[model samples]
Target: MPSVEAGTAGPLTALSPIRLEFAQKAFIVSGGRLLLVRKSASDPFHPGRWEVPGGRLEVEDDLDLDDHIRREVWEEVGLKIDPGPPFHLWQWFMPDRADLAGRGQVRVVATARRCRPVTVDATLENQESDDHLDGCAWVPLDEAGTYDLIPSLRPVMRAFLLAAG
Candidate 1:
């Protein structure tokens, strides 16, 4: 995957500038843990940051936002979400460039139930670099903030608190 230079620049531009586009993905939860990726202790996106599992929209995974979220959970986290009418908890928009060139947004969604955990092939989740992930584990929700996270993701953390209520 091509790494975008960090910024709020609308859209991942390439064929030349002047494109203002954005795609959506989410931070999903199940079994009291929010699935996360550790960016190889060497990636630029978060470089060792603990992040909600998700990625960009692709033509192949044709579905609405909710289905897209469900698909991403399986693809990135190795688990399937229950019959969920998943709702958006919060959205993190990339910082704007001039400072926005490399900017993107992530939406975090909390699911109601955790699926049966199954042994998964780690190779499937390798979106960018397999080295990016040190390991996968079910981490507690409260412990989320204990790890490095993008600024936009902060508010989504509150959803954990609400879910516990």
Candidate 2:
């Protein structure tokens, strides 16, 4: 994965290559812990590893970026989100790993937000439950590294936690 320096200059102006694509994501943080989902082992791209729940932007979504993120959050984690604008845009470089499967290496340009928390109920659970994840959890940012995480998301979680502060 590409490691761009993230301090004073921020991420976009950091050492990024030209091949990045914008993928909207929700940080989904609450009480110092963030929500993450582990994709099914059978799927491609960091399958069976923990990462923030999100996906590519769809064309007919018709909503603005914030609405897109709010929708994506519900779709992935079954939780309602109150987005606090965009905190940061992070560039993640995915490498070819065992779990990466048939997906090609690419840059994941992500825009993030801090979301309001809510309880996840059975209805919400059923709506958002996906085959990609074997399980999901809310882990503290510091402790999240210990989980089996997608290689590219490690820095993203860190970057947002720091940015949120």
Candidate 3:
């Protein structure tokens, strides 16, 4: 009989798997302005705060990462975007909620892709009534600091501004 070590690759499974949720964000920039969406007041996370347009990946969707981002942008802000390669990456653990039932906080890993509007005159609109977004704006990149943005995204915004300058 062979003894399996707990830390070895042999059949000793004692550790729980770490699950991370994947999400994508678009830094949609047009004419020196960045597109932002305001989360609804009742939103679970970052209520009434502004953030770039994007969302988590859906397992049911057959689209690739770029197309998923495009769909999210369209559904959230009614804009067609040409997504570029990811420019920034960030992750955050979800705050504890009653609904989680002691399952531990969910960790979300997100990528921020630089994107451009497909049309010069494309108008921004919140397409879904039940979507968490309540408002949209094309704020000048230099002036974005004045807005109430999501706290976790402050560093990313700062880096973007610094890089733009």
Candidate 4:
């Protein structure tokens, strides 16, 4: 949530060749299973893949990282989540999406629990225009591992499963 200092005129730009934008992911678990959504085949990146429910953080959101995750989850699946500590952080270049091309997306992934029992809504896809989430499921970690997932998420999912047991 911290911003570049006031006095440093060019430090932000000079520090990195590519601009790093902030994004977040929520690890929502309920009834010993994780909630996963399938991206529509029409998606530009990682189409037809399963992933945790979350999305990019926008400056207009006016939230810290944790709040952003909570908002994104609510917007996506209509579920309220209690966010916990960040479990992982990683950066990647999303060249497939024209708007995101040439920019480094820094994602902070956090674990969270549903505030209450709720149905996963496949109809409420979030702000990312290109990502069409068409299916939803509550699957055990082992079962989830068998499906094709967002490539960067596999390791984190495995680690969460192992720690959970």
> Clashes in each model (backbone N, CA, C under 3 Å)?
13, 2, 0, 0
Better of 1 and 2 by TM-score: 2
lDDT of 1: 0.50
Query: Which tens-of-lDDT digit does each residue in 89-153 have in candidate 3?
Result: 88987743543445445678988888889954434464665557878888998898778889878
Q: Candidate 1: misplaced stretches above 4 Å? A: 1-31, 86-132
Q: Pick the candidate with the highest TM-score.
A: 3
Off by over 4 Å in 4: 1-17, 96-128
- TM per candidate: 0.56, 0.66, 0.80, 0.71
What is the TM-score of candidate 4?
0.71
lDDT (Cα, tens digit) per residue for candidate 2, span 1-165: 466564655555544333444677666766778787777777566677877766656557637776777677676667777777666676766653433344545566777666666654312253343436666787887776578767767676677766656
lDDT of each: 0.50, 0.65, 0.78, 0.66
Candidates ranked by TM-score, best first? 3, 4, 2, 1
Per-residue CA lDDT of model 4 for 1-165, tens digit only, reads 466776764656644244356666676677777888888888767888998887776778646766787777777777766777765666555443334444544334334332333444434545455457777788886687888988887886777677677
